[model samples]
Target: MRVRVATTILGITAALLAVPACSTDTAPPARTEKPAEAARQAAPLSSATLETRLLDESDLGEGYLRKPERPSQHNDVTVIGCPSLSELGGDAATGGTLSFPRNAKADFTYGGSSSEVSEELYSDNAAKLSHGIDRIFDATTSCPTYQVLAGGTPIDMASQELPAPRGLGDEQWSQLLTFSTGDRSTVVKQTAIRDGSLLLIVSGSPALVDRHLDKALAKATTTS
Candidate 1:
């Protein structure tokens, strides 16, 4: 079974912390229920936002897709304005583990997992993840996926055969795609989940979707 993958955009750095205590070869499908209240309680700083910047390898840290600018405070919710996946080399999968600078105090770190899958399977799985998101989110791109949540309401999701790159190979790397929801007035995000790791790229600027190089990499530690 596939799980619908839900990621946090820059606006608020929040993800449901459902501990994967078991190392099951098969991950159960994602639950449709909203994220826990604990995540919602994090509360976002309305004024806090991410500045648009390049998503080049130079921009990446240890292995993370960093926000253009750091949030005002540690764990502060920062919105990634707009992004261009191509700038980050579009799914080539860089080698090495990625980590945020200690000074940045960013709450999450993603990328560089010991697990992997072939490009053929990765591409096929991306399609399933895409279809699952379409069932949950209002708008999204065909390849790389992105979604926006309204009023801090977290959307539950799942995916199957999510791929994790093992250092820039033929594996069709998944990326975050920007999109909007609701009245289309507020909230936008980008998402990329394969294998077990997921990346949520976000931005909020009312109908200003672009390919301009903006990205956020939120890493969740997964077991199994």
Candidate 2:
């Protein structure tokens, strides 16, 4: 069975928002660009614009096909069967999300292969957006190893930090996850890029993510 990993981060913002307001930890430094300037630099993406920028079936090689687009109203983490975002942190809403899937179905013992390109745009102020990203980064540091139950089967997932790819966005961080069950294993790589006010997430196999990075960046630049 193919597992759906897109819904993982919906509740993360809410959970993260639950954190006590009096915490003494300092927020990450503000970006050189002001919020208003960043917003002006990249206008928010419309549904129509997003559809045009999504990678088409022809973009992937033979055996790879484009799945229907199912955009969400929240961000996603890599956990397959996570029950709640509080497991990660925060209790308030965060951002809007859009996902494009390119899948390869195989009859092998393990489930078929799949990949996704997701974009999250934070409508909140720059401080909130930066704070949200910072919280995500900090959360990843503590939960390196975790498990989620998919269809009653426990899926083992592991997370590791990856250096950002060059020249794509203002700031970037990646999470490499390995999901395994029995003899079947899948590698889901996710890279998050903060370009102006948009958080572009590329997820799938490492090769797939790499292949789409430049295209994603180019399209993101045209978000006016």
With candidate 1 superimposed using the best TM-score fit, by how many Å does residue 217's alpha carbon deviate from the native?
14
The weakest ten consecutive residues by lDDT in model 1 span 114-123
lDDT of 1 at 169: 17
Identify the runs in model 1 with alpha carbons over 4 angstroms from their true place: 1-10, 13-72, 75-185, 191-202, 211-224
lDDT of 2 at 82: 34
TM-scores of the models, in the order given: 0.20, 0.59
lDDT of 2: 0.46
Total backbone collisions, model 2: 13
The residue-level lDDT of candidate 1 at 22 comes to 17
Tens digits of per-residue lDDT for model 2, 1-224 = 12234334422222212212211122332223234344434444454554555545555445555444344343443344333323433342122122222211111011223334333333333344555665665454345666655445665765566666645566666666666566666655566666665556666556656776777667655645
Report RMSD for candidate 2.
Answer: 10.9
Provide backbone clash counts, one per model.
21, 13
lDDT of each: 0.24, 0.46
TM-score of 1: 0.20
Q: Give the alpha carbon lDDT tens digit for every residue of 1-224 in model 1.
A: 12222222222223222111112142332223222211222111111121121133344445534333444333312122212212222111110011111111232223532111110011123234333333322222222432323345433222222123232111112222222333222223223333221222222221211222122231121111
